[model samples]
Structures are given as structure tokens and as C-alpha cells.
Target: MGSNVDNALFFLVSTLFKLAIWVLILRVALQLVRADFFNPVSQLVWRLTQPVVGPLSGIVPRYRQWDLAGVLVLYVLAVLYIYAVFAILDYRVGLLPALWLGLLSLITMTLMLLTFSIFVQAILSWLGPGVNNRAGSVLWSLNEPLLSRIRRIVPMVSGIDLSPLVAILLLQVFYYLVPLHPVLR
Candidate 1:
């Protein structure tokens, strides 16, 4: 396999795996926020993930509103993604290291996704404030938990809610500040 082919393969696999991982994160966050299950967006997430999460849901017990099955599936996908990346890059790493790297990658990706969701939510609000759309609704639901807490701490001034901005900054700091090079490396 040439370097170009390996790069292409890595890109393809990374995109597909990351897409699934993002959906799983949304699924878990949706449940955590108690988002409207009947919303079209919510239904789409459920249907898209059912084939993979349904079986795991049966095997993994739930804790309150937490989606343990979704979490398990996410971790497995993360590990598989890491393994695929290693193979594609021809890195001869050990299994345990891969497992640890997978965990780190998962957490990093999740935080990155959160930052993205908040950013998009802000855009949606700017584009159409008070718009009644399923996607926007889900986006708001995903963002409210974080924004609400921030809002409490940082009061709105002149009717401008600064929570989203503050939230994004905080999330950015946390994710970037966390050292990615684990003991395995």
C-alpha cells in the first residue's frame, strides 16, 4: 500500500467512524437532556443508531436516564477507530496502548463535538431566533444544559445572553489544556 492509498483509506475510515461516534454522542446527550423523543431529529438519531445500539441496549443495563448501551457502543467504536488508524498508518503499537489511546481520543472527540454543538446553536439562534424546527430544537436541547449553568454564573447584560460564548471558551480551554500524550506514548 502506497502512502497516498493509506492516506485515502485513513480519511475514509475516519470520516465514517467519526460520523457514527457523533451520532452516538448525540443519542446519549439527547437522553441526558430529556430532549423531545418525538421530534423528527430525535427519531432520526434513534433509527440511525438502532441497528447498532439496540442489541447493546439489551445487554448493557441502563442507569436512570443515562444511555449505558450508547456509551458502550461509543467506546467500542472509538477503539476500533483507533485500531483502524494504527493499521492504516502502519504503527506497531500494543493492544493496551491502543485501548488507552482510544479512550483519550473518545474524550477529546466528545469535547470537540460539544464545542461544535454550542457554536452551531449560536449560529442557529442568530439565523433564526424563535424558529420552530426539529433540528434547531434538538440543537437547543443539546446546548441548554451547558448554557443554562453558564447563564446562572454569567448574567445576561443588556438582554444579550453571554452564556454560549462563555461555555465555548470554557470547553475549549478544558479540551485543549488536557494533555493528549498519555503514558502509553
Candidate 2:
């Protein structure tokens, strides 16, 4: 295939694969955070990933709340995606390096999701005191755990709640400090 065509195809495939991975990530994170499993968004994530995770769950096993099956699936997908990137670039990477970077990529993506959710939640709140929706509920469920902790130390200034900003700042700092996006480069 021509370089341009190859790159385009790779982008399309990677995007779809990444979307699936994000859904799995959501499932794992939601379980870990003890989010309402019956929530529509939660159910959607579960139903979407059930086919793949169901089979792996038999072998990989779930440790308490952590979904190891989903995690294993994520790792395999990431490793394969990393390998594809290396191939497209006409370069080679060891399995260990690829594995390490693949895990980092997962963390990087999770951090991105949290950061983005925080922004959206903040926007929704600004729109009104009670902007209830399925998406907002899911975002709140995922982020409230972290944001509440920040709220304890950082008091609201006047009428403005800075918890979201404070939380994002901390998350961003951790995100950068962890070298989370190594595979991305």
C-alpha cells in the first residue's frame, strides 16, 4: 500500500480499536470506583465489552473489584497497536519495551478521560445547579471521588468552586510526571 493509504487505514483502525479500549477502561474504572453498576452508561459499557471480557474472564479471573479480564484485553490490544505503529514507521521494538509503553498509554488515556470529564462536568454545572443527564451522572460518578477529596483541602472562593480546577491541575501534574504518553511519541 502507498504510505498515505497505509497511514489512513492505520488511523481508522487505531481509532476504532482505541474507542473499544476506552469502553473497557471505563468498565474497569467504574468497578474500581464502585460506581452504580445499574446506571445506563455503566450498563452500556458492560454490554458492549461483555462478549470479549466474558470469555477472558474465565481464564484471567477478576481480583476483587478489579476487572483483570478487561485489563488483559487492553494490554493485548495496546501491544498489537504499538507493534503496528512500529511496523508503519519501519522500525523495530522489543516486546518488553512495547509492553511497558502500552501500559503507559493506557494510563495516559485514562488520565485524558478524567481530565476531559472534569471539564464537561464543570460546564454542565455552570449551565445550571441541576443539569441531570445520563452522561453527566456517569461523569459525576467517576470524578466525584477525586474531586470531593480536593474540595476538602481547597475551599470555594466566594461563590466559585475551584475544586474542578484544582483536581485537573493535580491530575495534569501527575499525568505529565508519570511519562504517561511515551508510546504516543
Candidate 3:
């Protein structure tokens, strides 16, 4: 019973942290993609994240197009999540190991976000070729630079763009092949 209760609590906490991390990521992506600032969704994302990011912005500072503050916050949240998971599993993590895992988690999250954006762009291409919403625009902006490069190499076949397929394949390969275990071990 105790084990079950612990597991349930772990799941709840982990889910909540993941949701917060996802929001932070979306906020960063929106900025990176230059999403329409006046859009309702964009405004909501900014408002939701501004509390944490607004202060951190002064300390971490932005580097050109990258939101270093937002990225640093994500890393801190990832580290906290890792520690929480370890505690729930009855294991204790050292600071160095926790930092390493946190860095790995951030990388994994960024790659997953990229893949998701590409996936959304591919879906939008099929559903509505002319769709022009904030989300759609953000996804396209995020994916276009990568997709265009892939397209240059892969080329379209039968008038269908295969760049997204190739881009996703490469991203997936990197995601799976990344040596995450070595860092943890």
C-alpha cells in the first residue's frame, strides 16, 4: 500500500512538472519562431511564463535570438524533476550526476519539441495548405530552416515534399541513439 501510494504521488508530481516544463518550452519556441505577439495564445503563453522568466531575464540575459534565461529555467526545472523522481524511487542523486541528467533531459526535451513542431507542420500541410494561425505559423517558422536544408539534399519526389520525413527520421535517430545511459551510470 505504501509503495502504491508513493508511486501515485510520484506520477502526479512528475506529470505536473512535465506540464510546466512543456509550457516553458512552448514559450521559448514561440519567441524563437517569432510568433505573432498580439495573438491570444501567444499572449497567454507570455503571461504564464513571464513571472519566472521576467526576473531570470535580467540575470541570465539573452544571446541574440536565444532565450538563455528561459533555457536556464528549463534546466533547473529538469534537475528538480530528476531529483524528485530519484527520491520517489528511494534513490539519492548527487549534485554532479543530477546536473548531468538535467542537461541530458533538456537536450531530449529540445529535440522532442523540434520533432513535434515538424510533425505539426507536416500535418498542417495536409489538412490545410493555406492555414495561417499563430500555432501553425510558429511550427512552420521553427521547422522551415531545418526542413529547407533537408529539402535541398533530399529533394521532392512526385511533387510531394519528403524533407519532413527525412528530417523527422534524422531527429528520431538522434533522439534514440543519444548515449543518455552513460551519463546516468
* lDDT leader: 1
Residue pairs with backbone atoms closer than 3 Å in model 3 (clashes): none
- Name the candidate, 1 or 3, with the larger lDDT value: 1
**TM-score of each predicted structure versus truth:** 0.91, 0.89, 0.87
Candidate 1 on 1-185: residue-level lDDT in tens?
A: 46887778777888898889889988988999999999999999999999999998888999999999998998889889888877876777788987887888777788889999889888888898988777888988988888898988999999888998999899888887766654211
Clashing pairs in 1: none
- Lowest lDDT sum, 10 consecutive residues, model 1, at 176-185
Question: Sorted by lDDT, highest first, which candidate order results?
Answer: 1, 2, 3
lDDT scores of the candidates, listed in order = 0.85, 0.83, 0.81
Candidate 2, run of 10 with poorest lDDT:
176-185
lDDT value for model 1 = 0.85
Per-residue accuracy of model 2 over 1-185 as CA lDDT, tens digit each: 46898879777767876787788888888888888888898999999999988998889878998999988887888788778777876778998989997888777778878898899899989887786888788888899999999989999899899999998888788789766445363
Question: Between prediction 2 and prediction 3, which has the larger lDDT?
Answer: 2
| Best prediction by TM-score | 1
